[model samples]
Target: MASSLRLLLPLLLLLICSIHGGRGQPCSTSDIRVEQRTTGASVEGQPEYQVTVSNTCDCPQSKVMLLCYGLNSVTDVDPRAIKPVDAKLCAVAGGRPLSKGTPVKFKYAWKTPQDFPVVSSEIHC
Candidate 1:
């Protein structure tokens, strides 16, 4: 019985890690969250919003792409931070890794708040 437990333990651990992206924690594109709030500031007579993009995964998220079609900001967004890939996508962090818990922040001004949804990301454990 003890021998069975010893063999089973490692198998269980391997299964768990595989299910959790090998970092002892779950990782997915959903782990990327974008939060925005009005900064109580205005640019070009439009309300400005402070946007924070954070990774909740235990591993680093790289090549994060966001849905950015029709996104225009009176407050200039830094191209190096995020730039338009095409008509419907934007690359975040210049296609670099976003460390866990460290957020990428930016500001944009528009008549209405825009939603930046995570389209895809590669998790680096």
Candidate 2:
């Protein structure tokens, strides 16, 4: 019984330390830009430009996904129907996980169908 207790003590301590040390990290976005322009002589014109969203975290993320949504400033456009390639490109920058302070770039070419109300975007991982 004494020998068994000694071996189990170290294993228990390691298990407790690993469990306490494990955590989920948060990823943040920064430097969002939107440029709008008129397409010919139409009242509703989609903007054409690429907005880059970067991951600013120390931990690596899995299954990262990016998406765009319509704002209240534009009523003629619906974001649900807008695919990344139609004007924007929703793609995986790379297969490897993003490192600390490293940015995952996403190129988007979309028209808001109106003026841009918000100058920021978001991502999920």
Candidate 3:
């Protein structure tokens, strides 16, 4: 009984480690493409836009992280206004899974006038 218990304990530990280790490693930056487009036009000093992330890899991706920053020489608009379309799915705890050729989108609105366009954005999985 003692020998069997010892063997089982190591196997259990290995199984647990493997399960946890396989998570949190999102796809590489090179495997994804991001694009931004204006939804319509600036409304009442605020601008609305949509950002899309496309998976270029052949496999499915999970736990994706997206960070977008705004750039404008005329005005200083808060970049944090850009948010995931689905807040719950894009939360830090876990992100939505994206399959190959599929894309995920986020919507953003600037509180102030955005004279410049979004020139910098990043993604990680």
Candidate 4:
């Protein structure tokens, strides 16, 4: 019994370590830029901005969701006025990932409610 217990103890510990080992080289893309556009202005209050989220990377890419916020404009409104947006993968060019550093994009339109302060927008992944 003592001999079997000793063997089992080391095996259990080794099993735990392997399970916790770090996973390497996740599918990663370069930092993206938010291309903002004002589609139709409001007669009053803050104007609506349409954000086009994009990924500009040189590899096969996939959409990654991130936290986004507005800055320097309104203090009383939500920092991340909009929900998390997903990064898009670039389409294939001749059966390959889009050109190196080309962007894959998605559009998100939102309006800053009256009295909400915001100057610039940002996203955190």
lDDT tens readout by residue for model 2, 1-39: 999999999898777555433332234333222333333
Candidate 2: C-alpha lDDT: 0.38
Clashing pairs in 1: none
TM-score of each: 0.83, 0.33, 0.45, 0.31
RMSD of each: 3.2, 10.2, 10.7, 13.5
Ranking by lDDT: 1, 3, 2, 4
Tens-place lDDT per residue, model 1, 1-125, is 99999999999999989867677666889889999999999899999998888998777899999998946898679786778899999999898999877888888899999889999999886
Better of 2 and 4 by TM-score: 2
Output the better candidate (1/3) by lDDT: 1
Error of 1 at 10 (Å): 6.3
Q: State how far residue 124 of model 4 sits from its true place (Å).
A: 20
Stronger candidate by TM-score (1 vs 2): 1
lDDT of candidate 4? 0.37
Off by over 4 Å in 3: 1-27, 68-94, 111-125
How good is model 3 by TM-score? 0.45
What does the lDDT read for residue 25 in candidate 1?
69
